[model samples]
Target: LVSYKRHLEIMGERNSYSKTDLDATFMRMKEDAMNNGQTKPGYNVQIATENQFITNYGIYWRPTDWGTMIPFLDSFRERYGTQSNEVVADSGYGNEANYAYMESNGIEAYVKYNMFHAETKRRYANNGFLVQNMYYNASEDYYVCPMGQHMERCGKQHSVSDLGYRSEVDVYRAVNCKGCPLRGMCYSSVIDRRSIKVNHRSDSFKKHARELLTSERGMMLRSSRPIEPEAVFGDIKFNHGFRRFRLKSNRKVRIEFGLVALAHNLRKYSAILSKRMMGRNHAYATI
Candidate 1:
């Protein structure tokens, strides 16, 4: 009983784990064969692919992609002796920590944050009430609200994550919204003033990431990102029937996935070679 309690302590916020396969964490599977959302014991598989070929793969106990990205990239660097020049991932992997890590490693982050989609919509884009839509003066370090109110920097704040990552934010507050025409639309504070907290570093990183994601080269990369890794996952899950790991524990599961990845690469290579040979035969026949 004491040992089971200790195991729970180690698991932390994770709700369920298989008693037999301790490494297999309980995660919501994406519509099983029955088309039902069922929580099942599984490992989060992270894969890096380029030109539709698997470059690196890692098995993580955590389900979310946010925390898995840094370690996955680290493993990729260790395996290849160099990190990728740029990374393109979906919003699930996008956060302040990942953005900061990519920046520190000198990799261009074309990742989207949680609010990226909402910000693209016409309502959110045109809404002057949102902090993002407000214009800020860089030199003076103050935001100009839609109602021509200056939100001055009031104080600084420090936030720490569960992983012990510390971020510094600047707090800004409008002088007054009393008797203002756009008071309710701009803010709903009882004090008649609007305040906002801005993580300047994170905001800067996201701005750069957003710019890269919208550029021609970035757009091309973004379009191809899903095809590269998703196709491999589709082949593994649907074609090869690898819905769940046959092994137990993190180490054994990693070994199982390593074999699967090897098979996938070999199959891709064979297909490419066969296509090239067929092309050669066709050319010879034409002559």
Candidate 2:
């Protein structure tokens, strides 16, 4: 029998793998063909598509989309010789590092974060009680709480991520709330004071991205972004029955996907040509 225990040590954070395909890492399968929420040995395939055509693709061992964006973009740059002017992605690709990278590379980001949707609800409206609802005076650098309390900057905090990215956050505290009537409603603190932390730079980046995402051009791109890659995924998975990889290693799997992508593009091209030909024939018959 194979040493399963030794394999587990080698695969930290990746719980399982196939004996035959050691390159495939265990990830939570979306379809879960067995309906048991079982982890399957698979590669997280990342693909970039434009105008419903696959522009670039990369097979990643990592399961999550968080840290995989940089490498995916790097692959795109390597293939195209330059980065795109704009990138439209869902909340999965929105983070500090990704935003910073895109900004530095002069790419307009139309991405959403985890709380973007939540903050749009009626409950999150400008009710004054919530920190998001509070109004800040940029000139004075102080926030006016719902109860008209001045929350001034108290201190600064520095946070470092696992990837060694450091972020500076400004801490703000309410001047005094010892006998405020809205204390319980505003916050649940026995000390009767409230504090809020803001990463100003990150917030600015998110604000810029949000503005771009809400613009007319951005909305058009956002609508088309889904149709581009999502349609390709549907065609590959449901239509072509490519739910699992037959190959064992990452390089081999990439080659397999390359063939699949090539076939898909050719099929699409043929369909377009056929439609044009039929249109011309119909015109000739009408004449």
Best by lDDT: 1
Q: List the pairs of residues colliding in candidate 2.
A: none
Report lDDT (Cα) of residue 14, candidate 2. 59
TM-score of each: 0.94, 0.90
In candidate 1, stretches whose alpha carbon ends up further than 4 angstroms from where it belongs are: 1-4, 9-15
Poorest stretch of ten by lDDT in candidate 1: 10-19
Q: List the residue pairs that clash in candidate 1.
A: none
- Where in model 2 is the C-alpha error above 4 Å? 1-9, 12-20, 31-34
lDDT of 2 by residue, 148-219 (tens): 889999999998976678999898999788889888788887876799988888888888887898899988
Q: Candidate 2, 168: how far from true, in Å?
A: 1.8
